[model samples]
Target: MRETPVLVRPGDADALAAGRHGDPFAVLGPHPVADGAVVRCFQPQAASVELLDGDQAVAMTRVHPDGLFAVRLAAEPARYRLRVTGRDGAVVESEDPYRFPPLLGSLDVHLLVEGTHHRLYQVLGAHPRAFDGVTGVGFAVWAPNAERVSVVGDFNGWDGRRHPMRLRHEAGVWELFIPGLDHGTIYKYEILARGGVMLPLKADPCGVWAERPPKTASLVWGQPPRPWDDGEWMRGRQRRADRHAPVSIYEVHLGSWRRRPDEGNRPLSYLELADELGDYVSEMGFTHVELLPVHEHPFGGSWGYQPVGLFAPTSRYGNPDEFRAFVERLHQRGIGVIIDWVAAHFPSDPHGLHWFDGTHLYEHQDPRLGVHRDWNTLIYNFGRTEVLNYLVANALYWLEEFHVDGLRVDAVASMLYLDYSREPGDWLPNRFGGNENLEAIDFLRQMNQLVYQEHPGAMTVAEESTAWPMVSRPVHLGGLGFGYKWNMGWMHDTLDYFSKDPIHRRYHHNQLTFAQLYAYHENFVLPLSHDEVVHGKGSLLGRMPGDEWQRFANLRAYYGFMWTQPGKKLLFMGGEFGQSSEWNVDASLDWHLTQYPVHQGVQRLVADLNRIYRTEPALHQFDTDQRGFAWIDCNDRDNSVLTWIRRAIDPHDFVVVAGNFTPIAREGYRVGVPEPGFYREILNTDSEWYGGSNVHNNGGVEAEDVAWHGHAWSILLRLPPLAVSVFKRDG
Candidate 1:
């Protein structure tokens, strides 16, 4: 033990050494004494400490044995450096971390507190910054309720007392600039609860980089100066992203999409995935690739849906820069990238936002408003400006930082309603006694408006399953302001209709027609998403009714019908090749299943469907307009046959689609045509190339001038068994 100096109080020295001081800034940095100015430092590993001013040394007295050193200066110096001698006499020099001014500006803090700051990520989190020629990491976090917050990491032996941050009282934000620290420094904030109870070390909520979990340390990083090459793509994306354009999305779960067995079945890295996935999607003619949640989460089973770090991209694939390269590569291939974004709820991880600062700072105090009963997660307190700013800034961070093309906002239905997935009397009503989450509604509209305003051509899509009005309409029009909504009703009804046996299919024929009643209500995406093929629901192929041959034919016909229908398209990874098993997060998708011809045929048919959907203006040019679709015959339920004409803006440019859901072929079936001209059989699902029994359509059919089904001309058609046929009228 070292002798306690008469000048140093026992209580102050003990608190500094013990690392529980609420205000380390008051004692450790330059302070005015009656004599002039005095500087104090607690260097626990130093045997002796010397203060240097322009080559002159003012030896510091060892006030306490635990390495507390103090020096009374005759005059305050402009700057000072500490020369520290280790226990083994190894001498080193460094600028003191405690002497720097606050790194954050007052305006930033004021905006942050008001919750109007859309760019909180620019200020909060650990950033490697150079200030006044001293390189170090600048740290900031909002923990207004904490008694003390310290920057703790490998540098200080994880000691909190060594670097307690300066609190900005008005904003409840704590900030510190530690000199000499650089990028790659792993760190966490040590926060003391208001009542003085020390809580668990918490990860930075706005951190840009993080250790791949089960490790929760936030890594200090600086934004690299990488040049973006997607300028043309960005400028022209609006034309391609609108409702009138072709938007065929190939949904992917990167981890399970493909794995290398030689590398212990590990998923591909970001670069590898960029090359492989980009080529595959481009070859299949998909306009965009939508990845499942890529935010950082601890559990691999959640597939990133229950995220803890909203700003950090999961290190499972790559770092932030690497993810940026992946997006650039996809853009080069004319493929847009959309990530699933979860703002509805978050998991109750100990190191996460749950009970942050020993209070419900990010969530609501009431369980009815804060907790999600079904997921066991915590709902965000959207009413709080800071909480709303955090989520909104997170959205902008991904879009601006990563050049992400879109965000598929997940579980939007849950966010829109207060009583989602809750029992009666288990949820809180809004101020108006309604079930609507008013604060959440405001947050969503604001987020969507900001995303579109800041990043042109970038879209915000909603995974909304309910009949929420105007989901895809503009905010100025009293809407949620999403670019598109997933057409869950169409998917459910279509799948249900296809699952029935042919003999009983006539009884359920209305299931196929019911979706048309509300199909045009919103700009929808007809999705065969991963949700339909997971958790014992089985693969799309497995749900089809029949023998192997019928199952393949049924799936091909369904794809053909979905493509020709009036909506944008989305299909999950395995559905294209017909993976037999349900989706398993840990296991690789059955890529081996494509070896069979039936699976190969399904993929080939999908490719053809995309080709047709892209080139045929009638199929994609007016996907959201009622004029694009006109039923020629929908009441033929006795034979389970349906026919419709899909038209473009110029009604003359149209394609007629007919589907036969039974195993029996219809020979010489009369179908009406709008024009007295030759109807070319552009595509037939029963074609020999697609693993079907060779059926005859001959090349085309000439329409006779006989009025039928409200049309002036009609054609005799041979509809193949369990197949879909498409025809175009030649000029």
Candidate 2:
């Protein structure tokens, strides 16, 4: 018969009696171990534990009848493995599971000792004062299945023999506490399995510091308090102005935005970029600046998606301190900054947080839930409690550390589905056998909740292309709780309509007009993001179907329609000036194109769009509120004409916008107006400032009342083709 395992409490006897059999794992002691202290693996499932010196296996004594085996060696440490055998006298498992160097398949095991696991790193604990001047170094891993684990890093010369970690059990967790080693010590783990298997060393899954060469864990130095001068800015945090308010966003990729002056044309430092780009964006009248991923990534050109160090800002840009300064500067300039955050998947780089602590920690252990076959990346197992903490902590870290105003989550569609881009038999369904990845959905909801709860003024945007409803709905309504979603339908419809030849565009006009039917369901942003120009899709200018002049004309018309549409506007770099060549991150934007009138016109149009958006209150008032916009005309598709009215909540003040898509100018066209009075032209696409013919109607025109339709009073005006006109009759 098996003997009951002895349980001991560090403090109270009554507490120990109540918790004795309830908790399966318990720490033997809070052993005060040195950096290179020697320890051993203990497991109940195995017959015995043997310490293997090279090819020789030294047998360990069984200390407990419950299958606890251990060994202690005093000799200088070197490469070693642990071997386990079953009761049948057969080799049950071997340590260092990988057959080759780098130890790819090694699982990270935690040694439960004291109140903590031997391999667990602590940041803030109950004994905070113990770490006051102590500069405590914390480590974390994502292994959920390992029976035993230990850490061995540069502080121990990557030797698993000399310094093995002890795992302390706490609330179903295994941890270890090392007192001596402070900051800047590289480490990896040695794990022993209950099945008698030896695995190679692995890094921490949530490690902030990592290196590729010599195979070592990251060394994190304690950070000092961030230097911020925007105390007033912090106090002013509030919900942003309504959606219809003039909103123009400039999307930028930091690395390629501008090159470094000193490092052979490398990217600019965060400080340098803040000084230059901040002023440029602010001067351009963009309310917000959306930056690509700023998270630490091993791959530069991947657009910051394969995040390994979620808490660490990418060292490639600058130090975390410098990045904070950059954000503070943007805040000082009264411009909101939004970062592209990728929470979908991470790269499988060994030095990263993939298998740190010798187990599948961050990702799912099973192939079904943990793998991202489409991107060759590791999918995060959001169902685990530790994993939830890891991700939630990351999101909060950015908001608290960087003081960012918003985040545009990348690839949300991928996170919303279990069988996304997966073939039959290749993917696993949830318990309900549904294609929806409920775990991912729960994680997204939790992340959004935490973000909003902690940062009230912050915004969360989703780059989801699928028709997932309630993406922009409130959290209480069973939604993913994003502030806004990219209007992908508008992007596709507008691109498809504009890519056609002028003669062919007449047939495709409905593509542009039809998007309004469902536009009110959620707050949306019209985006011409980096995806449109990369990978041989060609530049926006190249998408035009006509010769030089007509191409320019078509492009201008496209911009006109985009500006008049009811949504926030975001444009990628080089797009505002009609870049002829497709964007490549390796090269700079085509600044020399300013010499051409067409390019200058595009720039002017962008500027005017910003001005128009800002000056017209009607455009922004309807952002979240439903009653701000109304379509006055939707039927005139044959002549390529559409009309809409943006009215203030007061109903007395309003603006009427009309656009004609024909190639030639039209005269004496009777267009319906909301009010009969002097309807002055506020903006015209055919103006010379926007690279068009100088055929604009002067400042104000009086509209005479005539019996046209059932309404007795109507306005007759000359409407220019491929042009946008906004009129206002304010009493």
Candidate 3:
């Protein structure tokens, strides 16, 4: 054997063996010295090591007691493999991990440093990639304050010493390329903090797949993305996403929508939901399905509001590919998919982003700026460039990677204000002493601009309860730049008015008429969402007035009124069948309620309403246009009755709606019509088929050329109790 020259410095060798080397690449890879080249590696479990060059094996000397081995090479340094003999006498051969070049390119470093990398997910995560004609996984993470970081996983026996990473100071990113590791290798990062303390092992922030809850490790997922087959859907998507389109959404929490009772009440897998959920949404005739947040979260109790892995699909479902199949299946059934995005804040789990890298890197140091008191979570530091880049890239990731049609941004009001849910002195103000979160506003505007620019068909909706102005307006016009805004006032007022008894409804008549005062201020979505049915609030049917028959009638009439209103519609799950219990994330919806005729009738009426809403142009063509809706009579509070007309772009295409809120059938009620012709009764909420008294016009009535209620023609008909009816000019 030839003499083995000292390759590494005594201090460097000790650092490597001790697993505290800041730059392991310098000591543990092929290094060129003055005399020759040397290959050194740290294998804690190896008793001895040999370098394999071509057909020769060169024995390496153990430089340090903890299995640090090194040997000088005769020829110029080239690619080589390590044949490590373990203490148990088993020999294994693999390419040296540190000898490979940096996984991130110079351009990637520049972009990441500048925080403008829109596709950051692809670069800064555990990626199974091919490099230098060898297949392996490339690991990268941003941990600027860490003294040292190592990739610990099954291949390395969860030993940080086996694979300490090389830090690129320019981007604050640590990178390593292991030659033999492939997909499905579970891994985590062991970070040595600045104070020489070992922080908890952290999961990959950009991991695309993760371990199931309670076992918080990220998986190396290199599976090719599902090949898109919905070209037709993608092409016409922009056209269909207009304000004039029938935009009814069915909001559902996938886990609790329908669970397998026999299978320990577990939620259905993504692949199973691909068929069942898609089919149900299509059959119900909803234009889109808006799922509650599905990003990986630790607790099922939070209902996915508190997410940790922003890039990963939760393993409670199937893999990311299966989630893609679910989206595809929905598209195949002519339904669009929308997911809730929680970008305002994140949880404080040790493995999450809280106190990441031994610093408040992702959040603010001041609790006033960083803490969300309502959620007990840490708010993202919106002013920080890297944080903004991370959040914006995450939004694009969901829309582009998953083929999602829209994102309903949750708690936008919280993001918009610095003093949200905080006492006056407990909050901090902006640079201009304003309560507005200027940085968050900038981030939101940029995200919306990029989403609309990059994905033309995609949309963003804001769940902002505050009276924020122009929320749905374009960014160029100094607005927040959302496609739609949830009409909180309408939902609140409608629910409040309907919950009151009919005898007292006369005084609350303004609640029904006030929504129209500013209906066109923004592109509004009338959201009867899960917020109404959760958190101790009873179900939609449970809050109604009167006995069984009257309650059902009030529900049907309220539904009819909502559909005829000049806005897009959104209904939470189980509301169609009048479910009488509050929502519970741990249990499936009360599916058994549909067995009774009363509940079945409610379900049928909702289906019919959806069908009519989708088919009738007058009801949807001018949903956001002020000229579409006109009040015929709003001062009829004495009779608890109201009449209105909805029109399409062509005023000739219109429908008349008469609603009687009181429980009395007015047999000789007269209503105004637009034209002198036969008025066809298209829909009547009082029909016996919908569990109503069936007190409606026999078929229809001819409009006489009689001036009534400021109209050219009038029709006299029987208006059913607590019912709403629609009339179309057929002749």
Candidate 4:
């Protein structure tokens, strides 16, 4: 022993050796005492410890048998390093992590305590930082209920006792700045829970990057590089995302969209997908590509709906920077990106937020309010302000950090109703004794309002199935404040009518015309989404009930109708090529099916539909305005035909849609026209190019001043069998 231990207390040394000390910095760092500077270091496995002053060794006296070392030195030069020698004669040298100053500021602590820190990612994650000229990783986490939290990783051989973090009680956060630890460090928090029970090691909740799942560790990475080149695109997005503009979305499950068979059918990386997908979508003329949830999930079967890392893009593709490049590429090609965001529920994975800090910190305490029976997951406790801040910050993380164009909030109906998927007495109601989840509603409204306030051009769409009134209206007007809502009713009715046999089509004619009854009630997106193809609900092409040719004709007709209808449009991946089999998440889309003429025809029709929908103002300029649409004939149930006029805001410019459900072409069909002019058949689903029977109206038909269907003029036309024909008045 070189010097007498002066300021070290026996209890503090024992607590440090036992790894139960909440504030290691107060005991193990250089502290100024009455006489001089006393430096204490805890090295449980070390046989000896020495203070190193540029290769000069000053021996430290062992104050406790468990290896707590202290050295009393002159206060002139307080800064020192440690040279620790293990019992096996193995030696290592490192800077003292405890000597550095706090990385988080007063403002950060204030915002964190107030639960208003939208950029919690900046303050509470594993970030490579340099403090006091010493570079290392700065780690912080919110674990108010935890008795002790330690940063465990490969740097310390995954030992909790080696680095017990310092607790900032005011903000309920634990932080540690480990010198010499930088990027690529795989880490987890080993927490001694509130009840003295050692819980499972948990991954970082705000991790920006994570190990590819099955590994379950958070990787330390710096901020993503700033080389985005989509300034013009981002600036113009507000104009393109307007309600009056056409939004034809191609919803895709990225992992299953395409795969390289030679590489064991592995999904392409984000970098590879950027070029291939960008070219394909731009060529197809789709305005946006809605990616099925890309957040980090443990199980692939959940398709990212059950997420653990809310701020991390799934490492299944690439790192955060690569995802940024993907978004930049899509922006450069003028295609918007919308990611499915699942804030409704999360799986009960031990490594996830379940039992986080060994308490119900992120979710509810009661089973009635905590559990999601349908998914076997846990519902979030929206009543908690910190939890709400966590989720809202995550929403902005995708929007501002990754530059996503919008968010389609998944399973909104589940979040809206407290009794969702629950029977009587199986749920808890709000103070109002209503089924509505008031806290969740408040969270949703706050999230939407924050998104619009923070980002200018980005938007939000709700996948709400129930008849929740005013879902797409503003929050100030007593509504949910979403930019768009998925019209589940229209999707259901249209799919049901199309699935019926042609012989019984007349009985369900109302299904085809019923959508207009409440089309403008909310800004809607007609979604033929990934949900329709999974769980024994066959692919969109398989849903049509008929022989091969009739099936192709039916699908083409339905897409044409959906595109020309009064709302935005969304179609699932394989529907364009008429995939014969149901969607298998493990495999790629049946791209080979495009070789068949029938499938090729469907793909061709969808391309033309996107092109026409984007180019023609009459088809989209007033999608939410009632005056844009008028039924020419809704009473043709005997023939199972539907005809309507779609007018532009200019009034004179208009396009007419005529749909025939039966396979019998009607020749010399008299249809009413708004004006006496030359009407051109602009798009025909029955054209031979689209693999139909080539029933033709030639090119143009002249409207005569013969009153029919109470119109100013009428045109004698040929209605194709099981097809939809769109007409435009020529100038």
TM-scores of the candidates are 0.98, 0.78, 0.98, 0.98
Model 4 segments beyond 4 Å from truth?
Answer: 1-7, 87-90
Predicted candidate 2 versus true structure: per-residue lDDT over 193-276, tens digit per residue: 445355655555445545532334455544565668876666665545234455578999888877754668787788988899
Which ten residues in a row are the worst by lDDT in model 2?
A: 97-106
Worst 10 residues of 3 by lDDT: 1-10
- Ranking under lDDT, best-scoring first? 3, 4, 1, 2
Better of 1 and 2 by TM-score: 1
CA lDDT, candidate 1, residue 47: 91
Q: Candidate 1 — which residues are off by over 4 angstroms?
A: 1-10
lDDT for position 588 in model 2: 67
Q: TM-score of the candidate numbered 1?
A: 0.98
What is the TM-score of candidate 3? 0.98
Please, what are the lDDT tens digits per residue for candidate 1 over residues 617-642?
99998898888998999999999999
What is the alpha-carbon lDDT for the whole of candidate 3? 0.91
Tens-place lDDT digits, model 4, residues 480-558? 9999999999999999999999999899898988888899999999999888888998888888988989888999999
Candidate 1 vs candidate 3, TM-score winner: 3
Among residues 3 or more apart in sequence or in different chains, the pairs in candidate 3 whose N, CA or C atoms overlap within 3 Å are none
